[model samples]
Target: MTDKIRGSIGPDGPPWPVDLLADLHAGVLEPNRAADVRARVGDDPEARAVLAALDAVRTDLGALRDAPAPPMPDHLAARLDAALAEEARRAFGGAPSRPRPPRPAGRR
Candidate 1:
C-alpha cells in the first residue's frame, strides 16, 4: 500500500497524500495545486488506480440518493432526540425563548 503511494512521487518531492488526491478528484483543490497534482500523477499507474477508486465511491454514493431511506428505529430516535435536547439546553442555558434570526448569507 505504501509502495503504491510512493509510486506516484516525482523528482521534485514526496508522494502526494491520499487526501489531496481525493480533493483533486472531488474538484475541491485550488486550481494551481490541482494542476500540479495532475501533472505529477498523470503517468503513474498507482495514482490512476487511486483516482479510479475515488470515482467508483462517488458513483456508489450518488446512486444511494435515489434509494429509499430506511426509517430510524423508534428507540434510537427517542435516544437521539433526548441527546439533542440535552445539548441544546447545555449550549443555550435552556430552551431559547425565541427562534434565532437567520445568519446573513455569504462568507464571513
Candidate 2:
C-alpha cells in the first residue's frame, strides 16, 4: 500500500500525492463542501497538483470498481484474510472454525 501510494508500482508513480484521498472522501461526504475546497485548491499550484493526483487515483479506483475481480498476491491475500478473521473473532467471540478465503479484488 505504501509502495502504491508512493507511485513505486502503479502509474502516476511515486511523488503522487496521496492527500487527494481526504479531499475525495470529503467530496463523497459533502459534494458542496468539496466544491468549495476544490475552488481554493485551484488558486494554489501545490493544491492543484494534489487534486490532479487525487483525480488520477479516483480514476484508477473507479476502473477497479467497474471491472472484474483479479487474482491477488499471496501475502496481501493472507493479510486480508487475517484481518477479516480478527474482525470475525471480535464479532463472534471465537476464532472462525475455519479460515475463510480472501474477498475478490476490484472495487467493493
Candidate 3:
C-alpha cells in the first residue's frame, strides 16, 4: 500500500485518515491495498464512522446525477467566455494583429 493509503497515526484520534477512508469507500485503492484497508477499518469504529459519512455523501451525489443541473447565470457565462477567449489569445499568439490576404488557389 502507498503512503497515501497508509496514513500516519496521530495521538488525538482517527486511526485512519479521512482521505484514506474515502479512497477505500470510493473503491479507488488497488485490490490488495483495499483488502488491507478494509480489514483494518473493520476493527476501527472511527474509520467506520468516516466510511458511513462517505457512503451518505455518495448516495446524495448519485441522486443529483438524475436531477437537472442549474443553468449558469448569464453574467457568469459572459465572464467565463471572456476569460477563455483571453486565454486562447495568450496561448495562440493573439489572433494575428490583422487579417492576412487569402492564399492563391492550389498553392503549396
What lDDT tens digits, residue by residue, belong to model 3 across residues 1-108?
Answer: 333544677412456777777778889998998988788678778788878888898899999999987666655665666777777778887562433344344332
| Candidate 1: regions farther than 4 A off | 1-14, 75-108
Candidate 1: Cα lDDT at 50? 79
1 versus 3: better lDDT goes to: 3
Give each prediction's root-mean-square deviation over alpha carbons. Answer: 9.6, 11.4, 10.4
Q: How do the candidates rank by lDDT, highest first?
A: 3, 1, 2
Comparing 1 and 2 on TM-score, the stronger one: 1
Weakest lDDT window of 10 consecutive positions for candidate 1:
99-108
Clashing pairs in 3: none
Tens digits of per-residue lDDT, candidate 1, 33-100, equal 88887898887676688799999998999999989776666556656667777788888896634433
Per-residue lDDT of 34-83 in model 2, one digit per residue for the tens? 66555554555644576676678889999999996666776777777788
Residue pairs clashing, model 1:
none
The 10-residue segment with the lowest total lDDT in model 3? 99-108
Alpha-carbon local distance difference test for all models: 0.70, 0.59, 0.70
